[model samples]
Target: MSERVVRPVGRGFLFLDSHPAGCAAVVRRMAAEVEPRTPERRTALVVGSSSGYGLAATIAGLARYGVDGIGVSFEKAATARRTATAGWYRTAETAALATELGRSWTFVNADAYADTTKDDVLDLIAGKLGKIDHLIYSVAAPRRVDPRNGETYQSALKAIGAPHTTKSLAFDDGVPVLQEVGIDVATDDEIAQTVKVMGGEDWARWITALQDRDLLEPGFSTVALTYIGSELTGPLYRQGSIGAAKADLEQTALNLAKDGVTAMTSVNGAAVTQASSAIPGIGLYVSLLHKVTALQTPVEQSIALWDQLTGETPLDLDDEGRIRLDRWELTDDVQSAVRAQWESATQDNIAEVADAAWFLAEVRRLYGFDVPGVDYTAETEVDVEWPTTA
Candidate 1:
C-alpha cells in the first residue's frame, strides 16, 4: 500500500476526491453519539447506505437497535492514483464499528436500482439474516437505469409551472458569493424523468420482492426519506421536479398502506448533504436555517426517527400520514427569521446574516474534509479496505 497527503480536491460545489481517513473519522464520530438502547437482535436492509441520511440510518440501526443486516450502495473502489468515493470509506468504517459492537453486517457495492442487485440482497438476507424488520430507502441519485426497461432516467432540479428566480449562495474559489439564480421551468419529459429516477417505484419493488421471498418479519416496516421544504424554497423544491418526485413517493407510501405494508414517508429537515448541494437554492436556505435554528444532524434525525418507529408512545404523523421531522426547521420563528435574512443578505454581510462558513464547512465534511482532528497535511492512506461485502 501507499501513503500520501490527500487534500480536498474539486471546484465550487463539486468535489473530485474523498479522503478515506476523514470519512472513517466522521462515521466514528456519528457512531459515538448514538447510545445503544436495545440489545434486540433485529435485521434491517438499508439501501443507499453509504452517505448522508442513509449512512446515518445504518449507524443508528447498528448502534441503537443492535441490527445486523445488509447495506447497499454504489461506490467506486480506489485506484493506484485515485481515491475512492466517500461512501466507500464510510461503509467500510461502519462495518468496522459494527464489528466492534459484535454485530454482523454486509456491504453490497452495486446499483440499488437494479433487479439483479435486489435479488442478490434478498439471497444474502435469507442466508445471513433470515428476516428483515426494517427497510430504509434513502437513495438520492441524479440518474437511474430502469431495471425492467433498461432505459436511463435522469432527475432534474427545476421549477414546474413558471421560471423561478431566487437569491442563492455560490462559491467563488471557495469563498461564499451571494448571487441571483434563476431556474427555468422544466419540460414535461424532465418532470417525468425526475419522478422516474427519484420516485418510489424502486422502493415499492424492493418491498414487494422481500415479501414475495418471505423475508419480511411479522412487524416489518419501511421508511423512505423525503423532504418538503418550506414555502421559501417551494418554487424550486417543494413545487419543482424534485417535488413532483416526492409527491409520487408519498403516494407510494399510501399505496403500500393499502397493501398492508407499514411504510411511511419521512420528511427530513434541510441539512448540508451532497444531494442537497445540487439543488439550486438549497444552499442559501439551509445556511440561513442553520443560522436561525439549532438544526439536527442527519445522525440525530435518524436516531429520532428510529425512536419514533420503536418507541412506546404512538408514532406522530401529519395529516397525510407522513412523519414530520422538519417541524423544527419549518417553525414560524425560524422561517420568519430566514425570510428576513433572505431579503437583505449580501456578500458583505453573509457571515452575519447566514452561516455560509458553516455551510461550506459542512459540505466539505461530506467528502471527508474539514473534519476535526484529522491532519489533512499528513500522509494518509488513500486506499482503504471495505470491511465486509456480499
Candidate 2:
C-alpha cells in the first residue's frame, strides 16, 4: 500500500481532497481486488470516467487492481488549447502504463447521452474484449440536448422565479465573493431536453445493446452514481428538474440493474467527483462534507466506495437499495451542521461562514492548480494514447 500512487497519475490526481479519497486508493489493491470475477477476461467499462470520481474509479479498476478497462468520457476532451484536458492526458498516461501489466486500456471520446455513441460502444466491445464484467456510469452534465427536438437544456441553480444571492469562493484565489445568481426557469421544452439527456434512457439503451451483443456476463453488477442531496439543495438539486432527472436515474438503475445477467446491480455512489465541482454552491457543500468526514468520521471515501461494492455487509446504504458510500459528512448530523453554517454565511457577518479557504483551494487542486508540488507555469507535454482498434 505504501508503494501505491493514486490513479490519473501526476495530473490532477483523484480524491486529492483532504478526506476519504474515493476509488483512487482502492484500485491500487493487489490481484484480488482487480482479478477477473469470471473465467473470461475481466473487462470493465467506465462511462463519464474522465474526471472526478469516475476517473478515480478507472484508476482503481486498471492501475490499482490490474483490471483492463474501456473509458467513456463525455464533455471532457483531450484537446486542451490544442492539447488534452489534464484528466484526459492523465487517463491516457494511465492506459499507457497499464500496458506493462498486460492489462489493456482504451478510451472513447463519446457523448454517453447519444445513441450513436452507444452503438459505437457496442461495436467496440463486440470487436475486441468480447464481454464486460462490470459497468460504471459516472457522467453528469449540467446541460443537455434533445435528440428529437434539437433543443438545449440548461438547469437552474436557484428556485424558479427567485433571485437568490450567496457568497462564493474563487477557484483560483482563496477569496470569498458574493454571487447574486438566480435560477433560470426552464421552459417545458428545456425541462424535457434536460430529462432526456441526464435521464436513464441512454443508460438503459446501453445495457440493452450490450445484452443483445452478449457482452454482459450473467450477474455482472452495473452501478450508476446518484445523489439525493440534503434539503438545503432542494431547489437546485433534489427538487428541481435535475432532481427529476435524478429520480429518473434511480428508476433507471432499478430497471437496468436487472436482466439476471447473473450479477447486475446499480449503485448510486455518494457524490464526490470532478463533475460535482462545476455546480454553483456545490464546492462548499462537498468541502463541508469532506471536512466533517475527515474530522469526526472513521470512514474514508476511498475505502467506503470500494467496500460498498465488495463488502460482506449489506451493500445498500439505505432501504432504497442505493449503494451510498459511507460518507459520514452526508449523514444528518454533519449536513445539519453544514446547513446551519451555510445559512450563517453572510456579507455583514462573514465570521459565521466556515473558513473554507482550505477546502475551496483543495477543490481547485483537484484539477491541477495550487497543489503543493505542481509547477503550473512549466511547459510540460504529457503523453496520451487511444486504444488501438480495440
Candidate 3:
C-alpha cells in the first residue's frame, strides 16, 4: 500500500482530492447514528448512490432495515499519482461494513444515465437479489448524454424569464465576502436542455426497465429526491431553469403513479452540498439558515425517510402527494428570521450574522476534510479498492 499525505486541493466547494480514511470515517459515523431494527431480507437499488442524499439513503437501508443493496454511481478510481473521488472511498467502506454486518452489498461504477448500465444492474439483481423493495433516485448531474439520440445536454443554473440580481457570498483568499450577483435568463434551447438532463424522463426509463425485467417487488416503492427552497431563492431556484426541470421530475412521479407504480417525489431540506454550493445565493442563504436554525443533516433526513417508508405510521404527504421533509427549513418563522438577517447582512457583519465558518467547514467535510477524528498531517493511503464479492 502506498502512503502519503493527501490534502484537499480545490477552491470554493470544488474539491479535487479525497482522503480514504476520512471518507471511511464519515460513512461509519453515519452508520453509527442508526439503530439496527429487526432483520429483513429486503433489497434496494439506489441510483446515484455515492454522495449526498443518495449515500445517506444507502446507509439507512443497510443499517436500519438490514437490506441488501446495489449502489449505482459514476466515480473515478484512484491512480498511481492521484486519489480517488470521495464517493469512491465511501462506497468501498460501505461495502466492507455491509459484509461485516452480513448484508450483501455491491457497488456498480458505471454511467447511471446509460441503458447498458441498467441492463447490467438488472442482471446483477436477477442473479443476486430476486426483487427490489425500494428504488431511490437522487441524481444531481450537470450534464447528461441521451442514450437514445446520442446528444449531450447540459443543465443550466440560469433564471427563467428575466435577469435575476441577488446578494451572494464568495470566498476571497480564504475569507468570506458579500457580492451582488446576477444571472441572465436562459434561452429557449437552454431551458429545454436543462429539462432534458435534469428532468424525470430518465427516472421513468429506469422504472420501465425494472418492470420489464420483473424486478419490482409487490408493494415496491420509489422516490426521487427534490428541493423547493423558500421565496428568498425563488427567482433563481423556484423560477429558474433548474426549477423547470424539477417540475418535470415531480410530474413524472404523478405520471408513474397513474400507471400503477408507487412513485413519489421527496422534497428534502437544504444543506451544504457540492451541487448546492455552486448555485447563486445558496451559500449565503444556507449560512444564514445555519445561524438561525438547526438544519437536519442529509443522513438524518434519510433515516426519517426510511422510517416513513417502512414504519407502521402513514407518510405525511402534502396536497400534491409528495413527501415534505423540508417543512422545518421552510417554516414561516424560520424564513422570517432568515430574511431579517439577510436584510442586514454585509461583508463587515456577515461573520456575525451568518455562520460562514460552519458553511466552509461543511464544504470541507464533503471531500473528507474537516472531519472530527481525521488527522490531516498523517501519512494516508491514496489508492483504495472497492470490495468485490460474487
Candidate 4:
C-alpha cells in the first residue's frame, strides 16, 4: 500500500479524501435548527454547489429539510500527478452521505456561466427530481466569458472611489505575519468588467432559463450570496467594484421578484472561503473578527441563515429585501470592538490579538486537511470516480 503525502501548502492545500467526520460536523451542527421547521420535502438547484455555502446547504437540505438537490460546480478532476480540487472530493463524500441518509442528488462538474451547464442541471431536475422549490446561487469567479458573444470580462477587488490602505496577513513559511497592503481605485473599465463578471447578469440568466423550461415551481425562492462589511473594510468591499456588482445583483433581485419568483440576496458574514482568500485585506479582517465574534463555521453559518428564512422571522430583510445574516457581526458593540482592533492591528500585536491558528486550520479544513481524526498517513488513491446523474 502506498501512502499519500497530501498536506496543506502555504495558504491552501488539498487532502485526497473528504473527512467524513468533518462533513458530519456540518450536518450535525445544523440538524437541530431544522427538525421542527417548515418547508419540508423540497428540491433545490444550487449553482455553486460543490463547496462553501452551496455544499453546506445541499447536505443540510437533504439531511434536515428532506430536499433532494442537484449541485453544479466547476472543479478539476484528480490526476496521477496531483489531487483533484477539494470540491470534487466533497462531492464524492456528499454522495456517500446521501446514500446513507436515503437521499437523492446529482453533481455536475461544469462552468456555471455556461448555458449548457444550466441546461444539463435542469434536465437532471426535470427528469428525476421534478420542479425545484429553492435555488441557491453562490458562484464566485475572477473572470466570466459571455455565453452569447464569448467576450471575456474580468473582475477586480479594488476600492471604487479612492486608494485604500489596510493591514493584512501573509504566510511566511507557514507562519502568519502581518503586512501592509493597499487597494487602489479601480478604473472605469475595471468597475464595468467587475460588474459583468460578479454582478447579477449570470444569475438573472439562470432564473430566466429555469422559468422558460418551467423548472421552477410555484413559491420557488432564490438566494444569491453577497457580503457588506463594517466601516473598516467598506472601502475595499461595500464601496468597491464588487459592491457595484452586488448593487446590480440587488436590482436583479427586484426584477426577479416582479417575475413572480421570490428572489433576494443573502448577505453572509465574513468568513474565510476559497473566494475570500484572494481578496487583499480579508484574511486579516477574518482573523481579527474572531476576537469579537464566536466565528461560526461556514457550513453552520449557511444552515443558520437558511433556517432564518424558513423560521418564524419571515427572512427579515432590511428595506432592500436582502437577508442579513451578518446581524451578529454587525451589532453596534461588535462593530465598535472590531474597529478598535483594526486600528490597533500591528505586526507587533497580531499574534497576541488575533487567532491565527484557528484561521489557518479553517482554511486547511476546507480542503480536507487538518481535520480531527483523519488519518493522513493512510494509503489513498489519487483519483476517484465522480457521482453521475439518474
Which candidate, 1 or 4, would have the higher lDDT against the true structure? 1
Compose the digit string of candidate 2's lDDT tens values, residues 24-133.
Answer: 12222212234232222467888876665676666655543455668887534333223345455445545555675677777787777666777788787777677877
Residue-by-residue lDDT tens digits, candidate 1, 74-123: 99988876898999999989998888888989999999999999999999
Per-residue lDDT tens digits for candidate 4, residues 24-57, read 3433443444443344677888888777777767
List ranges where model 1 is wrong by over 4 Å: none
lDDT of each model, Cα atoms only?
0.89, 0.56, 0.90, 0.77
Give per-model CA RMSD: 1.2, 6.8, 1.2, 2.7
Give the range of the ten consecutive residues with the poorest summed lDDT in model 4: 11-20
Give RMSD (Å) of candidate 4 vs. truth: 2.7
Question: Model 3 shows how many backbone clashes?
Answer: 0
Greater lDDT among 2 and 3 belongs to 3
lDDT of 1 at 386: 72
Candidate 4 has what TM-score? 0.92
Model 1 pairs whose backbones collide: none
C-alpha displacement of 336 in model 1, angstroms? 0.5
Residue runs of model 3 more than 4 Å from their true location after superposition: none
> What is the alpha-carbon lDDT of model 1 when measured against the actual structure?
0.89
TM for every model, in the order presented, reads: 0.98, 0.76, 0.98, 0.92
